[model samples]
Target: MIDSDGFRPNVGIILANPQGEVLWARRIGQDAWQFPQGGINDRESPEEALFRELGEEVGLSINDVKIIACTRGWLRYRLPRRMVRQHSHPVCVGQKQKWFLLEMLCPDDRVCMDRTSSPEFDGWQWVSYWYPLGQVVSFKRDVYRKALRELAPRLLPMQEPASKHRKEQQVSRRRRQERPEC
Candidate 1:
């Protein structure tokens, strides 16, 4: 649902495999790739939306994945000017997402992107935890970085020094600038 601040209530999923890699899916017919995510319906809780999206987007049911953790609060990101739907009623300026980290309990063969008549993704892969930071759309780079960084410790140990972490973020930001928006 769209909130007073013009941000839509949404859920972002970060599905991680046993080896510390996160699921990254390519848009049905586009170069864009991202984690499984969807809006929270009018009466649905953040978690309900999460599970629904898990099945809709990735064909994974509740039994196929286990919830590991979620961001303590909403993490938001704004849409670029051209991407905003200005003509829609109660215009959405961006998304305020509750990000969840899920551990995959099913095998890779179980992922079916075309479970629905129309699929959100056509291909998928397992990528390093930090890969999406530099690869997601420009407007979403910051939010992705924040969500991944916050939820990562629960999935894997964070042994890097703070300085190294800062360095990695700086590098991810620079790389994000060089990538093209999809």
Candidate 2:
């Protein structure tokens, strides 16, 4: 539900494979790709909303994933003025999210986009852990960066310094490829 701060209460899921690559999904008919996320119902807790959204958006249940870590408090970002709905109740200016890091326990075949009547994504793939922050919509980038940074350390033996270093290098290479050579 939208809160008084003009932010919607939401949950962000960072579902990772055994190698630490996170699940990235493409929105139906749109170029945008992001981790699965959804609003929290008025009656549901953040954790409950997370599990529900996970299943609805990616066909995963609690049994299919192992919770690795979650944000300590709400991580928020503001929407640009043009994107805000001035007439809406609670006036959601953006989202205040509780991010969760989960490791896939089931086979990749279990991940489906149409498990629910209204699917949030049309296709999905596993990408490096730091990939979403750079690829998500600009407004949400900061929050994604913060969430991943905070949760990365808790991801256990997989989050070794060498792995993190490799991920950083990969991100740098991608950024270079996206920019035109001077």
Q: What C-alpha lDDT values do all the predictions have?
A: 0.87, 0.84
Candidate 1 local accuracy as lDDT? 0.87
lDDT of 2 by residue, 129-168 (tens): 8878779999999999999998786554444467467767
Residue-level lDDT of model 1, residues 32-110, one tens digit each, is 9998899999999999999999999999999998887788899999999998999998999999999998889999999
Give the Cα error of residue 105 in candidate 2, in Å: 0.4
Give per-model TM-scores: 0.86, 0.84
Q: Per-residue error at 90 for model 2, in Å? A: 2.4
